[model samples]
Target: MTQTHTHTHTHESHPAIIKRLRRAGGHLNSTIDMVVQGRNCLDIAQQLQAVEKAIQQAKKALIQEHLDHCLEDLVGPLGAGQRKAMDEFREITRYL
Candidate 1:
């Protein structure tokens, strides 16, 4: 069996993160309304794209804050496993 490691951090940007998610939720609702109203295809696509970007931005902000503040709590230099995890996180975030 493989052991799982967990790290905990006090999220200082929690409120800001919630605000961003709420904004994205609002954007999603607007997009839904546009679809229901039979809006133009181009307009609907643009709104969807906007919502996607907003969500990506929020994810980026949250990840950055985690790295900047939360990760700092680790004592001394990062070990191999930690470094690998960080690398994997960076790679996954490239889609944003």
Candidate 2:
């Protein structure tokens, strides 16, 4: 007897996402450095908040892309991968 196995792969915008995240990280690092250098506390706080918001926006964009492209294919009619993918999505949403 012979057995066969199948694998499915999903597309991801990893390079673009990495570039966005790196830019956000650079903003965060600069903000922290300003704070450490005795910059105005209020200004530092505002800059930090801006960096956080940017990071959140990038994360949301990546999640939306995944839902539109990857999840759509995985959860298509008659597919069996929806539950697992949705569970992962739920876990990810907990942090958002």
Candidate 3:
């Protein structure tokens, strides 16, 4: 049997996601500091939740960009390998 493959690449480096993740990390540190200072539980929880949401937003943006640019290219003018890659990407994203 002949095997065929399709490859897709992105020109956009997506630095914004990295910056957002860094900001989220800073928020997490602040939340930890609040906890260490004996702040109220509700306040700490709110800050932690904000960090989580920021991280989630960054993840969503990265995923959306990948789907829009990489996956779209793979699905067109390609073969079975590209479809397999898309399936793998979906599986990996299940954890996120």
* Each candidate's clash count: 0, 0, 0
Which scores greater on lDDT, model 1 or model 2?
A: 1
Q: What would the TM-score be for candidate 3 when compared with the true structure? A: 0.65
1-96 per-residue lDDT for model 1 (tens digits): 998669554577877778888888988999999999999989989988888877887788888776755665555567899878877887677666
Quote model 1's TM-score: 0.65
Q: What does candidate 3's lDDT look like per residue over 1-96, in tens digits?
A: 998658544446477888889999999999989999999999999999999988997887788777757667655664588768876876677577
In model 3, which residue pairs have backbone atoms overlapping below 3 Å?
Answer: none
Off by over 4 Å in 1: 1-10, 75-96
lDDT of each: 0.80, 0.75, 0.81
Point out where model 2 deviates above 4 Å. 1-12, 77-96
| Model 1 global lDDT (CA atoms, 0 to 1) | 0.80
Name the candidate that leads on lDDT: 3
Off by over 4 Å in 3: 1-13, 77-96
Clashing pairs in 2: none
Q: Which 10 successive residues of model 1 have the least lDDT summed?
A: 68-77
Residue 2 of model 3: what lDDT?
95
Worst 10 residues of 3 by lDDT: 4-13
Q: lDDT, candidate 1, residue 35? A: 97
